[model samples]
Target: MSNLSGKTAIAGIGATEFSKDSGRSELQLAAESILAALTDAGLTPADVDGLVTYTMEKNPEVEVARALGMGDIKYFGRVNFGGGAPGAVVLQAAMAVATGVADVVVCYRAFNERSGRRFGAGVQDRGTEPSAENAGYAWYTPHGLVTPAQWAAMAGRRYMHDSGATTEALGAVAVAARRHAATNPKAWFYERPITLEDHAESRWIAEPLRLLDCCQESDGAQALVIVSAERARDLPQKPAIIKAAAQGISGSTAMMTAYYGDDIGHLTEMTLVADQLWADAQLTPADIPTAIIYDHFTPYVLMQLESFGFCGRGEAKDFVRDGNVELGGRLPINTHGGQLGEAYIHGMNGVAEGVRQIRGTAVNQVADVQNTVVTGGAGVPTSGLILGADR
Candidate 1:
């Protein structure tokens, strides 16, 4: 079993209201969420000895620590891969706590993606920056695979052709998310649910990809507190144990455009992550009571279900259509409305929602939610986590 499993727990989670525009600096959002999380945990800033966040996050560790009036930090780090780093942040913090390197570690992500730099618009001019990373984009941007939606469209279409999954199958995922979002008071799309028919009628951002199938860009921040399970029990809230957390990158991966693979339709990186997480947690997909599969795009949600062994190859469409992913189904998914219905804070908010399920405080709570499998972005090197109720 993984040494880190069951050693650390999420003591608190906090986020500002999800919105299209926050009208505040990303740094301010990060600071406010961090403070809110600390307050929720009944722990002061002085208790924080470590910090973790996404490399894509605008606010640095020192800045957040200083702003929160936290004392000297003993450990601080950041994970990369765009929206795929949220769960990995928890993993890093859990390791630190388990190793006695820190007592309280905060994982956070904050951005003004909608109001500031819109990632969906795709790359423009980075001014001749010479880097191996930028070079990868050069190969596709020229052919108009500029936006994330476009890059996802290629793989999505190939999956549909290979698996015989229809656009209606993809619409099921959107309908489920919006259904949950309609009941969530904090969701930007609260009280607004979508139907599968609506998903079909929505205009295609990319062929075979409807506007509702793509996640909305939003401005917000989310933060979580990681501490030892022993300390967490003494906190105000019930702890969501970190059963397992992992990040994976398959060979020859090139961001979301790893088309050189034998199968452009497969998400090998997420499969690799799934292998590690199940092994580390000593559990299987059958053990999970609910899921928060990263829904940056609906097609990816299907691919993730397959990669994680929730269903047989090319059977995710049938699996979801059977109502297994809906609330009160076999596996209630994205109980917080997901990035599609909820604001997309680069999957940080998904992690927070996972904690809520474990705490039994979810707006759409699943009965006896003993385990929740939460995934980060797919179509690239990604990360995942298995959070369980304290044993």
Candidate 2:
């Protein structure tokens, strides 16, 4: 456990409308989301003295600040590992606020990921200039492992082998997410729930992963405003206290080709995140009544449940076997839909959902919710949050 835990809170969250195409520049979207977050916190851009964002996002922090006409930024940072970086953005902001490096920090990610560059479409061409980073991806890229589905299929197939989970189990995850999404107007799949059969029939992106198994390529941005827990109480909204914020990278971690580990089906990075979160927050899986696990891929959702000790290893298939993840189930997930149903903003939307859940303002609010979990991208160097309602 660390002193940083429970010291700060996410005071507000804001986002641009999710869509297939924003028809706007990424920078403009970044500015819009920041302004929205500031307003949501009942503050102006001048109140933000720190900024954190994804390294992969095209928008730069200084540029975004200038666009928003912000005050002098005392702290600025960029986190890596694609979607895995979202939680880290909040972690950075929380750390800054806790240490007084900055009084207020806004963490954001914005992009035209769908219309501009679809990550689902896979690697087209990496420029000649490369480094140690590309070497890991290079090992499998030449062997038909260029796409995320392809990489996930290798991992999912191994999971089924070790856990006896069938492709149908993966479909069940997609079904639960879509069912939640059906009622969420912000979800891309809102009012369009599917069945196990629909998942079976959907075209395959990879052998083990169907089109429904993968998440949507969305265009949008999400931002969160963070301040000291003391400061949050005086703000205009209820505070979602940051019980814990942690990031991890297992020894066996790779970009997406994390195939060197003893168990290919497991998300060890998430496990690492879980250990720190639970200890730092002084809580357990049983304490969390709601969750917003990343659903970029359905199988990873199952692995996350296991990694977080919600279920034993190789038991997630059974854990999610029924309608356990749907509304009114033991663990209702992605109430705003998910990356699969909601427009994917690289997991930032998931964190915002966590804030909403703690604030009791979620569109699909869970009953008597107290503690909530928000996980980042599962396969890469990841992060997570344990958010609780202020006592």
Prediction 2 global C-alpha lDDT: 0.89
In order, what lDDT does every prediction score?
A: 0.90, 0.89
The regions of model 1 sitting more than 4 angstroms off are: none
- Candidates' TM-scores? 0.98, 0.98
Total colliding residue pairs, candidate 2: 0
Off by over 4 Å in 2: none
- Model 1 agreement with the true structure over 105-177: per-residue lDDT tens digits: 9999998999999999987654457888888788888787888898888899999998888988899899899
Give lDDT for model 1.
Answer: 0.90
Model 1 misses residue 282 by how many Å? 1.3
True-vs-predicted CA distance for residue 8, candidate 1, Å: 0.4
